[model samples]
Target: MPDSAPPPEFGEASHEPTEALEPSAADLSRTRTEEAVPHTAIIVPILARGVTLGVTTFFRSRRDEAFDEDDLRLAEELVARAAVCLDNARRYTRERAAALVLQRSLLPHGVPPQEAVEAASFYRPADELSGLGGDWFDVIPLSGARVALVVGEVLGHGIEAAATMGQLRTAVRTLADLDLSPEELLAHLDDLVIQVTQEGHEADPGGVSGPGAVGASCLYAVYDPVGLRCELASAGHLAPAVVTPDGTVAFPDLPPGPALGLGGLPFESVDLPLEEGSVLAFYTDGLIAAPGAGKEGLRRALTERELPLDQLCRRIVDELAPSRPYTDDAALLMVRTRRLAASHVAAWDLPADPAVVARARLMAARQLGTWGLEELAFTTELVVSELVTNAIRHAAGPIRLRLILERTLICEVFDASSTSPHLRHARTTDEGGRGLFLISQFTRRWGTRYTAEGKVIWAEQPLDPDDTPARTSGD
Candidate 1:
């Protein structure tokens, strides 16, 4: 108990000293003993979003010169307080890691080098007890004709929230891959969260590392290549902001539902017009939710119609912050839409000639290439080939292929025949029935919509900036 007795090794819990992170007994002894043991001190760093908030530490020591049962008890009690600190620090670390990883791994590294349109982004982690809050935003290029945009948040903060955010994100990516409808994907994710929570799954969710859990609020949309329209869905998240051609910010009215994991049905995706020279901003609530953000703050700072997207992001991060770096997590995503060099069109025809098809191919390629949209071109051609062929062969009268790119490549074959194309499994040797099959195989998404001007068949594929080796059914 005498100060003369050499300080012990760094034990597991206490500074009792087993193996200090330091070197040797001589060095340990050489170090000031007062520096070694003192009263006790505990520190907690607030983590919000994914950034460090501030550190909170407490100091205490053995009442007696040496830690006795009562002193140990005090240490334990101190630990209880420190637990809050440690837990917060650990949460901040994990959440910060999760957010940074997600931000880097999930978001498009940067706009395509030579894109026709300009794009940029900004990120800020919440500063809080454990910046593990779950706000997230992401963008994925879909088939050359379209791109997928997402913004969402898992409930709560810490490892659980990050994990949940990751899970929902994965679900979005997977469902997007499956080419399922946005509505279907939301439903699927809802089911998944419930299943994981009530039961649990091996798959990790959001930023959480281990078997995943938690739930989220999400919005996923597809931006078309040609028309540049957006098809979006809301799941207990804030309504999106659209900066129009004339500098008008429009916020869609989102319907009601609990955030994911609270338990319920999936929210459906809705379609919106995405015009040229337009900017759309999607963000988690943390960006807009201060104690008094209300709608006015968002309208003025983050979602003002005339504001540039980069400016919007900066403003959101600047204004409306709680005391902590994250108090809760936060995320922001923005995109600017540019018009094609020239409008792409299906020329009127007297006959369904090979020349027409050639023209269509040339049109699609030129627009895609000029727009720096290599990803949607190949599939667009493939789709054009299938639809035009179908129009010429199966239906009578003038066949027209008009491209209405929103969420999918809507290929309309204005055939006299009112017959709808059906998706079917093909036989190995069969060539004729393979038209729709090829479209199905090549694209991540596909479907049809009946318009006044005949029927349209559409498909979606992962938008790629480069023509990397494509994945097959097996891949």
Candidate 2:
């Protein structure tokens, strides 16, 4: 039989090698086997959506009998069924490829180096036939040598889940920058998920709706290097595994609220004091919940305390799921806590008197010089004076000034009052409004955060290289 023939609607082409086929010698040669032995054959072209994919061939020895009308009809029916199946498979393959691409693009490419916590992550999408699912993790660097570790999963598979994941991840970064507490961040995230689900339904009534729509779980945590503390919150997600420096594993008690978009209840945050060198792990349920892998396996995988984080991740992947293709999307983020030493931080109490501003400035200059940050002395001294003066004037007595030397020179003023500071442009006639304004000009950035006891107004100035000379002078 010929591999392909003219459309049956146009009058099908059939060949009996015992007879000469039209289109002459070439047609006969193509339809004939290399042996050129006489034979009778029926060739049926397989068509999909009006395009010819290939052909189905049925050959019979010429001596037996030529193909009858009944036989031809049967061959046509078989090829018709095969064509539809092939077309569907091709479409599915294309769609899956696209979904996987979208999912990968939505995930973080790499974890940025953080001084507070060393982070490493691993992610694997489900096998192709299973479709792509939404699984994502992030390491967001926050102000004051703090980092936010996140892992989230959208409920179902394919492009919709991946898209929803991207939306949630973006919302997290934005909220994290606002310095929202863990519980507060999740609350805002829940609101966003509700908004997304509503908008998705309104925009596409038949698309992206139903049970799995907008259902997701997230584990959000913020780590502070100076305090060696982690504030964690979860939204119907798995509890994290914490490995102490001595390799003892423990899972902290944290409230896991209902999955986002479903729970209107307020999320609660837990404060965990992470010991120095403790390893904290955040992951989607797939890693531990997959068949044949249990929480025990996760603990065992993490118990290899001697391994570096990257190797530890590989070890976990190999031990937990050695299969080539994962059945569900899996993501794991491991962070090792590193505390800041006293040598890097300096704090002192300041009197509420104006005369003490010079003393604060002098202390700041001496500390900056000790840290090989003389280039920042002239600028940092003015910043300390302003922040302390403001705290003494606008806030209460027993004010405190703290200096932390990390990637930047952080000058903070702590007071007994909860009043937050605002930055405003000082009019030329005003002598008072310029404290914050001048501090703003000399520093890279500044902001205020409230602690349980009081509020701390902090300013950050980029630390110049040791060899670099002073960059600014007092105003």
How many pairs of residues collide in each model?
47, 0
Q: So what's the TM-score on candidate 1?
A: 0.58
Best lDDT among the predictions, by candidate number: 2
- List model 1 lDDT by residue over 167-215, tens digit each: 6777787777644556666677777777777554335334434434444
Residue 351, candidate 2: Cα error in Å is 2.7
Q: Score every model by TM-score.
A: 0.58, 0.78
Q: After superposition, how far is residue 162 of candidate 2 from its true place, in Å?
A: 1.0
Give the root-mean-square deviation of each candidate in angstroms.
10.5, 5.9
Query: Candidate 2 has which clashing residue pairs, if any?
Result: none
Q: How do the residues 226-307 of candidate 2 rate in per-residue lDDT, one tens digit apiece?
A: 9999999999988899999999998888999889999677898899988999999888877876677877889877888878
lDDT of 2 at 383: 85
Candidate 2, which segments miss by more than 4 Å at Cα? 1-97, 128-131, 199-208, 211-214, 323-327, 465-475
